[model samples]
Target: MSELRKTPLHDIHQSLGAKMVPFGGWHMPVQYSGILDEHRAVREAAGLFDVSHMGEIDIKGPHALDFVQMVTTNDASRLHAGQAQYSLFCNHNGGIVDDTLAYKISDGHYMLCVNASNTEKDFSWIKRQCTPDFDAEVTNVSSHYAQLAIQGPKAVGILNSLADKDLSSIPHFCFDYANLDGIDAMVSRTGYTGEDGFEIYLSPEKAAQLWQSIMKAGEKDGIKPIGLGARDTLRLEMKYSLYGNDISGETSPLEANLGWVVKFHKSDFIGKEALLGQKETGIKKKLVCLIVDGREIPRPGYEVYLDGRNIGLVTSGTKSPSLGRGVAMAYVENGLDKEGQSLQIMIRNKGVEARVINPPFYKKST
Candidate 1:
């Protein structure tokens, strides 16, 4: 087997006594103190994460906007400079290539933040689409930057203390260039944990310094370094889809409950025809959220049953630390995905009762 890659913060994670494991071709921290503690910390106070493993691809040229609009499902024409939008790259058959965040730096330049494991593959797929007719150039720029996420109710306050600019002014899904304690970085008001947060992108060399600075600044606020274990649970509680698990190359964004990002009104895109056809024909199955009964945790690949007949399988599942119960996202027969529909998940050969519920098992109190 090939050697696994390590992020710039790998040594720091090791020094902090993090449990390291292989994930998406990188050795990443699975937990620091513990999954439950870190999960609660993010939900209540704040938590930091090293997400440098994610990929960044830069597209630049006069035709960048046209290229971006053709490749992604979302309408890039609505995005102004300094803004980002969640979008998807779909295959010709309407299957997902990868869900991504498209950051519009300017009219001539754009950046795509994609999942770690699909970075190289996505880059190749993107390059193949840039024919001689299109003047855009695609470059994988993942190595040039390191990413850190400070998330939770207290996240903005903590980051504001260290940033030269007011972080609260940056609207959701928008970004700005800022200096944080002498570190030049791009701070985006976005996160996967379904909380108020900022994702800082800075030089790899300054990553450790910025991480330490943020930790110290938020010390009194009860900030903790979170790991992948809690990260999964946090996003799971919010019903956010993970690339490989919840959605894959075989799933369409419409069936995954991500139709909001697919704009059929836009000019032409990769899978426009196929998606339009699917829409006209109606979707046969849909991804739904489930609140599992009792303490039994549903896991990926677990079978879903409706009246003892197999209908689908769980895509992502966990015992939610925030909700204190097992929650899951699964694809089920289209007509049976109602808010109060009843279903069962086969766990350890025994059927566990679960009910289809509207998304987001955990919501912060207002």
Candidate 2:
């Protein structure tokens, strides 16, 4: 008996004949057709993602803005209603507690989308941080909503066919509530893949219907049901860091190469002081993207070497479906972290030649 939780679309995933697997305490589809097939679908046309397992927390009231400013790196005061910003919450020691998306719904209401693994921890942390004068009311609404990502080049066209709302006006990181055939939903112009797309949040009960509609609308463009394997690859290609894999408590934002996301200018957020200190001290172990020279695929935990001497380990690696080669991101000694420097990855007791490449391995063709 798998102890993992099931989303409302669990049955739908089964009906679609998806190969289910456990992911972060939830039973999710690892693939529908195949990883490569699904990956190509999203890359060439459109693909649907069942991301309902993600956590959503709502922050409400007059002091909501103030509350966010105290917890997150981005200045929440900069966000207007219906806008979303990518941000981070850090521990005092400059370690990333979690990376999150903050969406301002209205004048005093906001929604924070977080990684599923950190839902409880994030909620508890925010609760403790709410001040006596902070008039915000926080609620964990993860189970109340279901999120579907419609991604690819033709995603907008497919989305346009399914809903009445005009998506053209909805710029990136912006969202609006609209009726998807009388099912109240929030549609946001955002996606993990480096392509034009939308993420739809709606009632769990209506998710299957919406999912079917999206596929039908995108039939001409060749939409396919994607899974976690492809999702990971897509985000990796975009150089987007995964929570536990790329950035975690042990990894600081500066070392993870996400220095841009960490806003030090903000007035006193968690980890601000520590991050500033680390920045001045010089980042020692920094994340670097690498491309293996041969057919040998480098996997995570593979030791990295500079001049045949061990210095780091691969944090995340994959046989890049898009690149037809092995690519990985790893924490390496700063002194040996020069881009284009020749390095080695220990794969199966064998040293494989590799080179430090500027992340992301997949660059959009001009």
Candidate 3:
């Protein structure tokens, strides 16, 4: 196997004794301090994450908006300058290419935040679809910036101290260009963990410096660097779909409960035909949340059963730190997917009883 790539925060993670692991071809910290501790920290106080491994692609020019609208499932026209919206790219047959965040920098300029693993493929796929007739440019600029996420109830207060502008006015899904501790950055009110948080996008050279500054500034607020383990648990609790795991090139957005992102009223987009057909014919399977009755943690690839007959496979599963139970998401045959329906998850040759339920398992404290 090839060597794993390291993010800009590699040295910092090593210095802090993080348990590094290979994830999506990157050497990432799976845990530091401990997964449970880090998970609780983010829930109660605040935690920082080095998400520099994410990919960024810039699309600009007169036809940028038009091209983006044609390729993505979301309505780009709804986004104003400085606003961001969750969107997805789908194959012609309706399978997902990747779930992405579309950032509208201006009318004729946009940025796409895609999963690290699918960056190259996504860029190439998008470029291939840009016909010569359209005046647009696509650039894969993933390496140009490092990303950081500060998440929790206290995230705003901690980051607000170091930011030159007031962050409260940004609102959810909105962003602004700001100077953070003298470093230029694109600060957005966005995050994976269903918490009030901010993600900072800045040059790689300024990453470590800004990381240290934020940690020092938030010391009184109990801020610590979080690792990927908690990041998974946190997002899982929120039912945020992880690429390749929960949603992938093999899955359709409608079957994955992402129908809200698909806009059919707009002009034709990639996969619109297939998606429309699927909607007309109805999906054969659906993604649903599963909560195990016992401590036996459910895992991916495990068979899901209904009435002693195998019906589906687990996609993502874990012992939820917030709920204190084994929770999971699985794609089950359509007829069996209903909230509160009892099912079984096969773990180690034994069928563990589980219940199908609606997600966002851990409600954020209001």
Candidate 4:
């Protein structure tokens, strides 16, 4: 087996007594103090995460915007410089290749933040799509920076202390260059958790220093170093899709309830035809959130049933720390996904009763 990669914060995680595990080919911290503790911290106070394993790809040159627009589902033309939009690259058949965050750095420059597991695939796909006549350069720049996600209700106050400029002014989805703890960084008011937060991208060499600075700055705010365990539960509470689990190459964005990111009126994209057909013909299946009453937590791959007939399978699930109940997301037949619909998840040879509902299962404090 190939050796797993480690992030810049790997040593720090070990020093903190984290439980490390393999994740998407990287040695990642799955928990430190505990998943529940870190989860609660993010909900009530704040938590920090090392997300440097995520991929960063840059597209530049006169046809950058055009090239990006051709590959992604969202309308890139709608984005202003320094603005980012959640988008997806779909195959010709409308199946998602990967969901990405496309950042418009300038008229002819763009950056794509993609899932770690799909990094190579996404980059290769993007490169192959750049026809010989296309005037653009696609660069894989994942190794150049480290990413930190500081998330929670008090996230702003914590980062504001170390930032050279006020972070409050950088609204969600917008990014700007800033000086963080004496290191040049790109600060974006974006997070996977359903909390007000910032995702900081900085030089890999400066990552440890910046991580320590943020930890010290947020000491009084009860900020804790979070791990993948908490990050999964946190994002699950928000119904955010994890690449290999909630969404994948086999799932169409329409089936994943990601139609909002698909713009059909825009010029031809990779999956425009297939998606258009799906829209016109109607999506046969839809993603739905399920709230289970008891402790039998529904888990991924669990079969979902309605009226004693198997309909679909669970994508992601957790015993939510915030809600104190089990929550899950599954793909079921389209008509069975309506809110308040009853369903059952088969766990441990028994069917656990559940109800379909909409999410963000846990909303952030305003």
TM-score of each: 0.99, 0.97, 0.99, 0.98
**Cα-lDDT of candidate 1:** 0.94
lDDT digits (tens) for residues 210-317 of candidate 3:
999999989999998999999999999999999999998889999999999999999989999999999999998999999999999998899999878999999999
Lowest summed lDDT across 10 adjacent residues in model 2 is found at 176-185
- Sorted on lDDT, best first, the list reads 1, 3, 4, 2
**lDDT value, candidate 2, whole model:** 0.88
- Deviating ranges (above 4 Å) for candidate 3: none
Candidate 4 RMSD to the real structure: 0.9
* Total backbone collisions, model 3: 0
Question: Which model scores highest in lDDT?
Answer: 1
TM-score of 4: 0.98
Tens-place lDDT per residue, model 4, 170-238, is 989999999988999999889999899999888999999999999999999999999999999999999
lDDT of each: 0.94, 0.88, 0.94, 0.93
Model 1 lDDT tens row, 141-213:
9999899999999999999999888989999999999999999999999999999999988999999999999
Across 149-235, the per-residue lDDT of candidate 2 in tens digits comes to: 999988988887766778778989999887765567899988888878988889988988888877777888899999999999888
| Candidate that scores best on TM-score | 1
Candidate 1 TM-score to native: 0.99
Candidate 2: where is the Cα deviation over 4 Å? none
Candidate 4 clashing pairs, residues 3+ apart or interchain: none
